[model samples]
Structures are given as structure tokens and as C-alpha cells.
Target: MTHRIALCGDLLDLTADPGWQVDAGPAVRFRPDSCLLIDEAGRVAGVEADAAAVDAWLGSAGQRVDCRGRLVTPGFVDTHVHAPQLDVIASFGTELLDWLNTYTFPAERKFADALEARRGAELFLDALLACGTTSAMVFPTVHKVSAEALFEAGEARGMRLLAGKVLMDRHAPEGLLDDVEQAERDCVDLIERWHGRSRLAYAVTPRFAATSTPEQLQMAGRLCAAYPGVYLQTHVAENRAEVRWMAELFPAARSYLDIYAGHGLVHDRSVFAHGIWLDDADRAVLRDARASIAFCPSSNMFIGSGLFDWGQAEAQGVAVHLGSDVGGGTALSQLRTMADGYKVLALQGQKLTAWKALYAATLGAASQLRLEHEIGSFRPGTLADLVVWDWAQGPVAQRRLEVARDLHERVFAWMTLGDERNVVATWVAGRERYRRPDATAIPQPAR
Candidate 1:
């Protein structure tokens, strides 16, 4: 039993880094009235522009989805998000430390209940798919059950998910904390069970330097070494106050990122979120180690955290990508993240070009996760995780799109104005996972 799907639309694919300049060689390939052929194994067969070849693909056994008026691109990859923090979104009036106590901790505590964890996981994944995000690196809770539930839900939906049980042995709530020994055992079990299992991976999630004791942080690094290729995710220099607190907490460390480096956690697989207050020295370390920064713009603005310098990070050769940061951030849509990111950069007298922003959300993020070969492109044999989007449904956006003279201009309009509403359908591994109800539906599959 083979299932194939042919998607005909305005296809856009990023082949290489577009850099900051528009004339950086053939970085992006755009094909109008093109057809994407998904093979039986749920991988991309090719993108055909020839009318006869397109007709032949449509005449084959699979279903032909008419996406004539829409845009198709690789599904977005959210570099940082918290699975247990879905209920924490839009909570008002607090900075990072206080907000965590007020909303984030309380919300995550609910995941101690297996049923609650399961329910939250399902809803979180669905919301991500609805926003055209097919892959994400998520934070569950200190409870082993929370990580298990998230992994289970992601597996059922066939989404690419990287998550781990949080390690927090000190500083804050009692119930949410885990002892270093027990946390290690739990992580080993989870890595054995879920890592490398069907589009899933494990990340050693320490809830930042403030939450974890020195012992726990060292143990987290040890686990990364014990299990080669496991990822490391945590926050860093997100707020001025947080940075000051980290300085006091780890007095001997040279800088905020130095604490992680001291513990042997600075590696190519590490993803440090926020990074608003980091200096050139930190950026150099990240670039040298091949580590990445998950630039969470919406969350930074909402929490009143300082702005991250996009140009500075890029100039220093640090890999930077977008993250929703959910509860602290407003929405799961990467489009919204990019919009906020543009403003973040603008405030610092910088520009986030349309191609650069889109590439960061999709291929750039994938490169950070080391999954670029698997997801993030329309290259033959890559997984067909894609999003079909309507350029504009409202009059204001339609007018803007109508007057746009080039691909970059039209995309800039959509990136600023678009939300989940622009997403008409989402496909994970060539199987439709989400479809807008108000939009005309695709025909049934050919059996």
C-alpha cells in the first residue's frame, strides 16, 4: 500500500545560505506553476516545471492537490519552545524570574499528572501544526512522565520533536526539582527509549544556570558525553537581571556562557535561547564550538528582556534561528516570530530581509539541529514536510501583494502581515496533518 501526493503551486525552496545580500548567487529557487512530486516512501521525488512532466505525475496513482493559487515551502522548524508552557502564553506583567514563579512553574506542575501531560502534549503539537511548524525542540518538565507524554504524542502525529526532562535540583519550587542522580537515570532511560526513534531525539534540558545547581549542570554535560550526539538546550543572558543573577551565582565563571563551557556543555549540539545580553567574547565561543542561539524575539519583547543583536551574531558567525518561546512569546506561528524579529532588529538599526528570515525559520533552524539533510529542503529523498499557504486573504494584504514587484517584496509583506490564517494546509512526511476548514479541501486519495 503506497500513498503518494502531487502538490501543484508556487514552489519556493532555499538551496543555500542567502546571506544578507539579495545577489548572493542562486540561493533560493522559485518556480511558479510548479509541481512537487512526493514518492511512495513519503520523500520528495522532484519539483517538475515542465507541463508534460507535471501532467504525467498527476496522472499517476496518487492524489493531485490543486494548490494553484497558494505558496508551498518547507515546513517551519521551531528551534525552542516549551511543551508544558502552552497554558503560560499571554500571562501579563512580569519579567523572566518572577514570571516563571507566577505562571511557568505552576503551569508545568500540572504536567505531573500523566493525563494532563498527554492532553497538553496533543494540544501543543496540534497548535504547532496549525501554525505550519512541523518540527520543534521542546521543553517538557522535570517529571519523566512529562517527557514521555510529549514524545508519545509527537510520535503519533509523525512530527520531528526533540525534548527532554528538565534538570532542576535547586533554586525554586520543590515539586518541580529533580535530584541529579535520579535525573540522570531518568534521562538515560528516555535516551534509550526515544532517541533516534522515528523523527524523535533527546535534548539534555537544564532550565538555565539559575535553576540548576553546579552539580546538576555538570551531570547534564556528562550525559551529553555519555551519549554521543544528544542535544543540549537551555537559556542564557536573556535579561539584564538574569545575567546579573548568573554572575552572582557562578562568580568564578568569566561570562554567562562560560558556566556552560566550564561544565563541558558547549558543543555543536547545544542550543542556547535568548542571548540578548551576550558580548563579542560569548559569540566567538559559540561560533568556535558550532553551537547555536535560538533568537526568541516575541518572548524577549513580552518579558521586557533586552534586544538581541542579529547583525552582530551573524557577523561573528554564530548560528541564529527563531523560537516561539510559547508562554512568554505570544504565538506559535514562526511568521509572527519573524515579524517580531524584524522589529527587534529594526530597533537596533538593522534589517531582516525576507529571504534571510524565512531561511532561518526553515533551513537555518534545521542546520542548527543537524537535521538539514533530513528535513528543511525539497531535495530528492528528503522528507516532504511542507506548508501550503495563501498569500493574502484580506483586502489590505491582497493590495500589498498585488503591488509587490518581486519575490522578496511579496514575502516581506506576508512575513509582516501573516499569521496562522495564511496557512491553508500542513503536511508532515507527505501526509496531511492539518487543513484549513474554510478553504476548499483536497480530493480523496487514489486507493
Candidate 2:
């Protein structure tokens, strides 16, 4: 077929968030023996169509790309990441604050040079695509140069991106912190230029309550309010020391979540990272405000911070999105993050199913970014941000699937052990970005 483009194998889409309770529904909607058809316009024509529909779309006038019977999911969305922290993702043991001082500050300072920031942006987005992450709401360093570098890269690649300048004015190293007035100024400038340009979006990012004084957080809120559809991102109660500092800094506020609420930053579009130490009241407030969370399980476990209660949050109706939390998070792959989330929850006597884990990375993340209508599913008219998964990429993955009893069990085993190797090709808006080298694509064993 000359004009064929179809993603075959297991076609999965997350119809619910991770924090959802098991409803009267099938165990997380799985589509097996499926193929997703996409047109040259980058819209999903249909997924798992009947033989005729698949043949018609494929034979229609467009270039052809095939997945060769691998799992195909909507490209993953990363709700939380530090554009500047990509340099130190697995830096050996440093708690949040110390990590910033020892590694983040010096590294971010290099980004003041636009050339350096651009280099990092290319490397960062390339790494994300290799892991099947099509969209992300990322934290740029305090320098406006950092956001510009990322925006240019996204523009070049047709990426559906959300990014911003870090707003900080207090409790941070001098070189890294921005004054309240200047920080808000940079945000407004970036928002004005890039907030809704193409697939690009801007976020009002206040590094955290600790780094941002009351004045800075209020400014961030004003920026979010001014930009109509812009997003707000920040760290909430991620670590014990951070929580104590939040309590001390915002003594007048009710709790850590309350600090952002007081500034109008807690809205339907806000996504707080590392909600590891939340209480019932905290979950209630976040749910009520409709703000979401980017759960950083790998970062939490890597730093020995605290175990996140995924089960409790979902029961309360608070949406939980997934994040790699790079430099802080151990890997750039969302597949790796899903495995980490599953392991941590299991140890706490809670179970994270394959569907729930996938949700955290895809539609669940799109909901947090309020970009669900555009990305994160196999739904017709959604962007063709698709990933072709290779099930038998390695010995172990192939062995597990060979003996798997059920569909969910097969998917569960894949998420638990899969890495970038399982990702055969990643496409964003129907444009192929990364394809594993032929040498890395192992041939099938004799049947």
C-alpha cells in the first residue's frame, strides 16, 4: 500500500484518571487486535477500524507508516518537569533543598546563555520523545532565555508544549532567584508572545512557595488570570522539610495547599507536583478547586521523601497526572515512572492496575493540562500523537508475554518492566520524531 499509515497491535486509551474508583465498567477498557489509522493531516481517522476502514484510510492519498503489531497508545503527557534539572536527573542522594543548592543552581546558571539553553532544550525534548511523551508542561529556569529556547525547539518539532519561566524571589540562591517585579514581567512577556501560538502554551510557574514570597505567588496568580487559558504549576507538599518551611513561611495560610489557593493560583488549570504528603482536607480542597497533581513516585522513592496515597486521592475525585520529574526523577521514560508508581503503591498494600498506571501518563495528564480535547487518546479528531510499542524487544518482556494469562496481565507486565527499548517509534502530530535504530530492532524468534 503506497499511502498507508496505521498503528497496529494493542491500542490503548485512558478513559479515566488514576485517582478514579473502580466503577461499573470493564477493567479499564482495552482494545486488542487493533490498528489506529491516521491521515496526513495528523488527525486520527479511526482506531481499530474494520478491515475496509483500515484499508480505505491506508490506500487513501498519504504517506504510509506501520507499527508491525506492537502496542500503540496516545503519546504520553508529562505534567511536571524541570527544563533546567535535566542535567542532574539521577544525581546521587540529595534531598530537595540540598539538591537544588548542590546541583540545580549552578546548572541553571548556565542557561542564562541562550545558546546553552537551546542545546539543553533539544536534548530534553529528544529524550522525552524517545520515551513516547508527546506533550509536557515543563518548568523553565528563571531566565526568560530558557523559555525562548524551549519554545523555538517545540516550534521546530510541531510539539504540543506548555512551558514558562520560573518565578522566584526569595529563599533561593541569588543567581537563581528572580525579583518579584522582574519575574512577573518575564511571565507576561512570554505569555503574550507564546501562550497560544500554534501547539505551544505558557504556564505561570512559581518555583514553589518557599522560593516565591507571598508577593511572587500573587503575581503568578495574576499572570494565570490574565492569560485566560494559561496554566499554573508549582511544587506543593513534596518533602517533610519543604512542608515545615511552607508552614513557617505561610503561617497565615491554612496549609501547604492553602498557600497557592490564597494567591488564586489553585484553579482548574493548576497542576501541583509531588502531592506526596497530602491530607484529606488537602485532597478535598484540591478537588473542590479542580486543581490536579503530577505525582512523582520515582522522585519520591529516590529521595526517601514519603509514600503517596494514590488510592485516597482518586476516591476523593482529585485528578492525579504522571511526571518524570527529571534530574529529580530517576529516568526520562514515563514507562519507568509507571513501574515505579506501581511498585511503591504495591508496597503500601495498594494496587495500581495497568490501566490506572497508563492513565497517569496519557489522558490523565491531558486532563491536567486541559488539553484532553486535542491530545491523549485514540479518539477520532485527536492529534496523531502515537507510540508504537515493541512487546518482544528483549528476552524478559517476550518471556512474560508468552506466558501471560490475560490481556491486562500482559499490559501490566509490560508497564512494570518496559523501558525505551519497548518503544519502537514515537510520532507527534503524525510526524515521526524518533525511530529505534534497525540494529536495536530485534528480529522475531522462530515460531
| Top candidate, metric lDDT | 1
Q: Write candidate 1's Cα lDDT for 302-416 as tens digits.
A: 9999899989998999999999999899999999999999999999998898889988998888888889888888889889999999998699999999999978888889999
Worst 10 residues of 1 by lDDT: 438-447
Q: Candidate 1, which segments miss by more than 4 Å at Cα?
A: 58-60, 445-447
For model 1 the TM-score comes to 0.98
Residues 1-447, candidate 2: write the lDDT tens digits: 223466656677776653434341553656777667766677787775476666665664544344446788889998888877887877886898888889888899899898999999999999889988889889878889999999999888888999898887887776787888877777788888997898999888888888887888888878877777988888988999989989988899888998888889988888899898888998999999898888999988887788888778888989887888987888888988999998888888997877877877887777677777889887788988988887666787789989998777787888887998778878888777888876244232111
Candidate 1: lDDT of 330? 95
Task: Tell me, by TM-score, which candidate is best.
Answer: 1
Per-prediction TM-score to the true structure, in the order listed: 0.98, 0.93
Please list the C-alpha lDDT of all candidates, in the order they appear: 0.91, 0.81
RMSD to native, candidate 1: 1.3
Tell me how candidate 1 scores on lDDT. Answer: 0.91
